[model samples]
Target chain A: MIAPFKTSYLQDMALTKTPLAKASYAGLLIALAAIPLVTGEFYVGELGGLFIFAIAGVGLMLLTGYTGLVSLGHAAFLGIGAYAHAIMLAQGVPFLVSLPLAGLITAAFGIAIGVPTLRMSGLYLAISTLAFGSIIGTVLQKWDKLTGGFDGFPVRPPTILGMKVQGAIGTYYTSLIVLVLVIWVALNILRAPLGRAMVAIRDSEISAQSMGINLAVTKSIAFGISAGITGLAGGLYAHYVRHLAPDSFDILLSIQLVTIVFIGGLGSMHGAIFGAVFMRLLPQAIAMVRDDLPFGLGRTPGLEPSLFGLILVLVIMFEPGGINGRWVKLKHWCKAFPLHRRAASRRQKSYAKSERLR
Target chain B: MESLVGLLQLVINGAATGCIYGLIALGFVLIYKATEMVNFAQGEIMMLGGFAAYTFVGKFGMNYWVGSGLAILATAAFGYLLDAVVLRRVIGQPQFAVVMLTLGLAFIFRAGAGIAWGYDSVAFVTPFTNSIVKFGSGVVLGADNLSIIFGTLVLCGVLYLFFSRTRLGIAMQASSQNQLAAYYMGIPVRRVFSLIWAISAGVAAVAAILLVPVQMVDVNSGIVGFKAFAAAVLGGFGSIPGALVGGVVVGVVEQLAGFYLPTGFQEVTSNIVLLAVLILRPQGLFGQVIRKRV
Candidate 1:
């Protein structure tokens, strides 16, 4: 809770506000890098999956959390990216060239979907995006010549400089590096004026427009950037799985991405990571404990989805700000510790009067 | 001559299925009118209703019509309970939260149905036998399809009368228009919302009853609800008659596309129509253009 004083302009704009914060981040990075060394192959693969989801989560956080656009079709963009990369790789293109090209192709699709949709807001936008996603899924299935239809197609392992990245270890390290690069880029974007504009638009589109922010361009760019990042994650996922299917990128996946973004805490960088890790690891944790339950619940085929839905509902109801919000609150509480006041612990309720009027 | 007969048969089949979609779309429209939140669980509720009816008839050996009526009542009660227990807590939250909650509810409903129904398609017994009715020039209609269309018409007429002539329905309408004013004017807004949810679920149950005879009831039956959602959107989300019209259009289009177009386009035809409508005429055919106040 103690405010850090910045002595210089350089200090003010630094990634971490204090030396302690910087050290913690460095320590966290070291721990992440050391994960594969300590964990078994299965755990390492799960961590890789976690990183891939985190990357996509960050992209969605940009659009939904910061840009205030709720899209239910993000998985479609991911599918597009996955398909694009698979096709490019099939055509004898190298991994390096195909990856970024996949991102660009997905970004173009994002812009194409966004330009017409940017005018609509809230429920309308959500429905349109849902429709858009369904269409992508349909196209992926029907366009069998390109997508291989329902049976799906296998993806070749990504190779760099004539060396193939093999097994969970290589995939984990590659994903970690990609995740770091993505986080760095995202942080830079968040610190820039573009990020501020997105936040402004989220707060009040009318006010943002009145302040000379180009609503159309800013919204489209946000979609493009978000989709591009998500597409990159999709490409990584496809390469990691070595297989692709239309069903893998369905509405359920889109909902899962949204859940991660919300559960991680909206509009925060660390929140996205927290959410991805929580969501990805949750099913495994549930599976581990399923057999030990008192009831005969272990035999149930759909317990995981039921539990997930219950958790989502509970999180939204009790902690709207998600894990990041809870973490900040805990941090504040610990800082106040013995001298903690009830007033200080009370959470702020942000109910808008306008919503009631509408 | 055979192709023309096949086309007529497809249209007839499409119209029958469209009636079910229209009925489910009515559920979406009613809830949206009452609470501005799109209940993604609407489809799941229909699926659950179908399963409930299936259990009543298939397991218990109850008469078809009696089982369906009981199922409708039970589902309505479930809907009321859902509103009271879960949705009531998150009433004032953002639209996204509400929508997500409904989606979560959907997941729960789907999972619950899967657990209860064992993830298998079950035959739903109807009062009418599956006798084929031959018409002019070899154009044929199944008895179940005829019943589906007739059932839809009866449900529509009843709903129309209830909404137009009843005091409770008038109050519900008042609450939808302006909740605060309705509350101020001595209307029980909370109860009205609960009733709306109940009615929506009941309508969905009817749709399920009608649909079950044609297609076997299964866990994946909820998938059809998305097409119903598309129909609702195409009809201008909150419009009652629009839902019916949109449902028919979507159903016909889907049938035509599945028969005429390359394989798999049928599954996505509604979504394609929905997207086109959203982009070209977001207000829908019957919906008024919504203006945001800065």
Candidate 2:
């Protein structure tokens, strides 16, 4: 293989380095845009759900993947966004206004949780977030007057400017637009110093701090942005679910979001999409084969969770780099087909040490 | 005086349940101390123990004491295999990898138990079941509650003597403190860690056996693992005595909250307490703040 000739730094550092890259990306976008027109409503709706989850997955990827913060309670942010959007829409806010507003509200909640967590990291952060999620869940459940409590809350049909987003197509287009916007923002963040700082913090918090990064402020911002993005996804999700159940945003959903970040490939935006695709497809794949199995395993109530658990364990043990990582490895292998050694550039990372280990 | 007796009964009941939580938390802390890995499936292991006891005693009509003993040994063996086969592989991975691994294992365990025992709750007759003890001045407590307290005390005492007096226990402690140094000193570090896991699981089994008369064993009974997680954190993660104290505090507070607080607050007391502890004092009551150069 030969390297591409680069005339300038601008050419060297361009997001789409080659004409082939640009063309392929454009082709992918075009395909996605035209997809709803050709596909059936069921698929379109499912894809819309995919987009919504992608948005949240990307949001969580920013925090857990890039920033190295594990949040076991991200579903709280999703709920906050959904509930906020529903409440605002119910009170006569326009769709465009309500969505961003919902994002802002959830960001505030994120900061609220994040500010207290300045001194916390890893296990403590995870545990606190778990507790925080349960607290918020209870609030959503018991706060009957506002969230409608156990009876569930209804979301009004969102109208942008003067047009109402009515069905599968509207949700599909809206969510796709949001996903694209989120990806754009996330990419821009990656290019910026902030994203570098986040990566640095993930690699070594002490080193990041020594390098003059404002640990508190940067962590808060990461939390806010991550939550805000998840909230936006939640607003999109409100449309997908129609009637909002408080229990929907739970540890399981939070785990699903983390699964997206893990299975997709940490530190890469494309992982979010790949992860979202897998997340949506697994259940469908199971459903397709549910009736054909020989044993009563087909009728097992907890099959989905166990399958998820199995996938998680397998991925961690064998493919910790996730699907995106595997894709990169495959690409590398193909590019260097004859000369590629198994040990080439396999960076061995150490475990996260507790204080005692340190 | 009557109210005092009522309060004593509540405290006693709370302590009984607290003992269970402590034992489970002890399971968590033991592994955390030994391997720097938190086993999120500790409660699930307990649930397995309960079901195994049910199979032996309830289904096969075996003697309760003997059945429970076998169940403990079985669970301990399972824990050993779990660490040897699954957990040992993730030795150098990120901390979250282990955390997620155990959580996944919890899911698999629950599903496995569901498959083996069915999803319904099961129980067996115990010596302490349905028996009550009367104190002077109209104070009465369930024999199950007394058994749990007495059993926990005896277990703790036994554990203390073993850790201090026995060479294997000392080896386990040394391995937990510094794996490399212990390995250099002729300790089979991996085997010691596995033994610690076995002991942890055995403790969980004891808790499950003690809890059988109080509550039925179901697949979801592993939900207690979350609360026990809270208990372990409250006890400062790695402190043995602190874990017990924290569990008792949480259990007593829970009982008190259920008795006095509004209907909804009862369910969230431990969560709130956990959050409060995490935010205010991350090291917990008995834990030292270990500041690393990293």
Best by lDDT: 2
Q: Which 10-residue window in model 1 chain B sums to the lowest lDDT?
A: B285-294
lDDT of 2 by residue, A1-358 (tens): 2235699977744666679978998899899999988999999999999999999999999998899887888999999999999999999988889999999999999998888765665777777788888888888999989999989998888888788887888999999999989998888887688998999988878789899999888988998999999999999899999899988888888888888888898877889899999999999999999999888798999999888888988988888888988888887889888888777647576653653533
Q: lDDT tens digits, residues B1-294, model 2?
A: 878989999999999988999999999999999998889889899999899889999999999999999999999999999999999889887777788888888889989999999989999899999999998778889999999999999999999999999999999999988887998999999999999999999999999999999999999998888788778889999999989999999999999999999888877888898888877887889986665554
RMSD of 2: 2.3
Write one digit per residue (lDDT tens) for candidate 1, span A1-358.
2234568977756777778988998999999999887889998888888999999999999988898788889999989999999899889999889989999999999989888868765676677778889999888988888899988988887787799987888778877888899888888887788988999988887789899999989999999999999999988888778789888888989989999988898888888999998998898888899889775778777787777788888888888878988887788779778786767646555532233232
List of chain A TM-scores, every candidate: 0.93, 0.94
> How high is the lDDT of residue B137 in model 2?
75
Candidate 2 TM-score, true structure as reference: 0.96
After superposing candidate 2, which stretches have Cα over 4 Å from the reference? A1-19, A345-352, A355-358, B292-294
Candidate 1 lDDT (Cα, 0 to 1): 0.86
